[model samples]
Target: MIQEKRSKRGALLGLAASILVLVLVIVLENTLAPTSQLFVVLKKGAVYSLVAVSMNLVNGFTGLFSLGQAGFMLLGAYTYAILTVPVSAKDTVYYLFGGSAVKFSLPDLFGGVDTPTGLILGVLLAIILGGCVAAFFAWLIGLPVLRLKSDYLAIATLGFAEIIRAIFQWQALGPITNGANMITQIPTFNNFNITDESGKVVFRLSAFFPMLIMIICVALIVMLINSSYGRAFKAIREDEIAAEAMGINLAKHKMLSFVISSFFSGVGGALFAMFANNAQAKVYTSTMTYEILLIVVIGGIGSISGSVLSTFLYVACSEWWLRGLDMGSFLGIKLGLFRNGFRMVVFSVVIMIVVLFFRQGIMGNKEITDLLKPRKKTKEVAK
Candidate 1:
C-alpha cells in the first residue's frame, strides 16, 4: 500500500512538473521571444500539434483506423468561418443561398450584440456545437463500422470522408457551407478587437492565448488516458477478444473513443479555420486525411508525446523549409526540375521508408518518459 501511494505521488509530481515547464516555456516565448525564430516555429507548429494529439487519441490509443479526420476538420472549419466572419463582407455574399440578401445579425440574448464579446462568444459556441454534432456522427458511424477489421475499417472511413466531401460539394447546403465558391474577407481572430488607429489593443488574440488553450486540452486528454477508462482502451488495443473476455464493454469503449476523437478534431478544425482567416469550404480530399495519418504513423502510433514532437517537425518542414527550398542551389548544380509538388513526393517517400524499415515509427509505442528510466548504480566506487 505504501509503495502504491508513493507511485501515485510520484506520478502527480511528474505531471505537475511537466505542466510548470510547459507554462514557463509558453511565457518565455510570448514575453521575451515573441519575434524569435523559435516562436515562429511554435506558432506554425500549433495547428499540426492539435491534429496529431487528437489523432493519437483515436488511432494510437483506441486502435481505430479512421481516415475521416479531414472531413470532421472541414466541418468545424466551415462552421467557425460562418459564425465568426462579419456578415457584411463581400465574401459573405458568396456564402448566401436562395437569392436573398443575408444580413448580419447576432442574437439579442448575447449582450451588446455589436461588440467583440458577442462575436467571440458566438465563434466559441459554434466550435463547441459543431464539435458535438460531429461527435454524434462519429458515434453513429462507429457503431456499425467499428465491427470490421483493419483494412475494412480504413476503407469504410475513407468512404465516409468522400461522402462528406460530396455533401459539401452539393449545392443543397449552400446557405450554410457556401458550396465550392471560396469564402473570403474573413476577419482574423487577432484582428477582432476594438483597436485605436495606432493599434494599441483593446483586445487581441495573443500568441500565448491559443497555446494556453491547447495546453488545457492536452492536460485533459492526458488525465483521461491515465484513468481506468484509458486502461480499458489499452486492453482493447492489445487484444479485443481478451478485453471482451475481461467483461469490458467493447462497443461502449469504441464509441466513446470515436466520439472523443471527433470532438477534439472539431476543436482543432475550428482553430485552423480561425487561424486561416475563415477560408471558404472546399471538397475535403484524401490528401488532408492522409497527411494527418502520416503524421501519426511517423510519430509512432499510440504515443502522444511522439505525435506532438513529430507534428512540430512535420509542420516546420512543410511551412518553412519545404516552401523555401531552392532547387537550383543543390550541390553547385541547378536542379530546377523539382516543382511545387516536390515536398509532397519527398514526404510520401519518407513515409514509405519509415513503414518499411522502422515499422514501429519514431518512439515505437513508448512515450518520452519511457525512454528515461533511472540508471542503476554500481558498487565499484566503494573499492
Candidate 2:
C-alpha cells in the first residue's frame, strides 16, 4: 500500500512539473521571445496539436486506423472561412462569382459595436459552426465505414477524403467554395483592435492564450481517457472480440469516439483558418493527413501527452530553428541550403530514426504517470 501511495504521489508530481514547464514556455514566449517568430511557431503547433490529439483518440485509444482527418479539417476550414469573411471584403476581385454566395452581416442588436468585437464574434461563430458540421459528417460516415477494419478502413477513409476534395473542386460548388480559385481578404486575428493610438487594446494572438486553450482541450481529453470510459476504449483497442464478450457495446463506443474526435478536429481547423487568415481547399490534401498521422505515430500511439509534447518540439525544430536559419551567415560559412526543403528532409529522417530505434515512440504505451514512479527501495531487516 505504501508503494502504491508513493506511485500515485510521483504521478501527481510529474503532472505538476509538466504543467509548470508549459506555463513557463508560454510566459517566455509572451514576454521575451520575438513576437512574429513566436506567434508563427505557437500558432502552427497549436493547430497540429489538435490534429494529433484527435487522431490519437481514434487510432491510439480506440484502435482505429483513420486517415481522413485532413478531409474533416478541410471541411471545417472552409465552413469557418465562408461564414466569417466580411461582406465588403467579399465584393473584391477575389470573390468573383458573388451571387448569394456570402452571408450578409447582421446588424448589431445590442447598441453600437466595434471592429474587434465583430471579429471575435465571427471567430467564435466559425468554431461552433465548424464543430457542428464536422460532427454531422462523422455520424454520416461512421454508420457505414465504421463497419470495416485495418487496411479496408484506411482505404475507405482515404477515399472519403478524396471525395470531399473532389466535391470542393467541382465547379457546381463554386458558388460556395470559389472552387480552385483561392479565397482571400480573410482578416487576420491581429487585425482587430480598439487602440487609442497607445496600442493598449492590441488583442494580439498572445502565445499564452492559444496555448492555454490547447492545453485545456488536451487536459479534458486526458481526463476522459483516464476515466472508466477510457479504460473501455483501451479494452476495445486491445481486443474488440473479448471487449464485446464482456458486455461492452463496440459500435456505440466507436461512434462516440469518432464524433468527439471529429468535433475537436473541426475546432482545430477553424483555429487554423483564423490564424492563416485564408482558407484554401487545395491545401487540404492526402499529404496533410499523412503528416498528422506521422506526428501521432512518432509521438506514441494512444498517448495524449506524447502528442502535445511532440507537436511543440516538432514545430519548434522545423519552423523556428531549421527553416528560419540564416544559412548565408551560419558560422560565417556559405551553407545556404539549410533554409528550404532541408528542414523537411531532416525532420523526415528524424522520424525514420525514431521509428527504427523506438518503434513504440517516446511514451510507448505508457502515460506520463508511468515514467515518474519512485524506485522501490529494498527493505533490510536486522543483519
Which numbered prediction scores highest in lDDT against the true structure? 2
The deviation in Å at residue 10 for candidate 1 is 7.7
**Residue pairs in clash, model 1:** none
Per-residue lDDT tens digits for candidate 2, residues 1-383, read 97567555744654566467566655565466345566677778888898789889989999988888988887888787777656666666245576437655321211112454565666666677887788789889999999899789888988888898888777777777877766665644444433566657433334554555566667667767767788888899999999999989999998888888888788777767767767787888899888888888888998776787677778778777665443433345556575656667778898999888888887777666555435633121100
Query: How much is 1 displaced in model 1, in angstroms?
Result: 6.5
lDDT of each: 0.67, 0.72
Per-prediction RMSD in angstroms? 5.8, 6.0
The Cα error of candidate 1 at residue 229, in Å, is 1.2
Per-residue lDDT tens digits for candidate 1, residues 1-383, read 96456446545544665566456555565456334555455554566567677878888898878888877777766655665445545343563564313345232224333455665566567667657766777777888898988789888988887787777767777766666765554434454434676767543344454555565666667667878888898898889999999999998998888888887777777767766665444635778888888888888998877777787788777666665343434345456755667767777788899989998888878766555434632211100
Q: Give the residue spans of candidate 1 off by over 4 A.
A: 1-41, 95-116, 185-187, 192-206, 330-339, 373-383
What residue pairs clash in candidate 2, if any at all? Answer: none
Which stretch of 10 consecutive residues in model 1 shows the poorest summed lDDT?
374-383
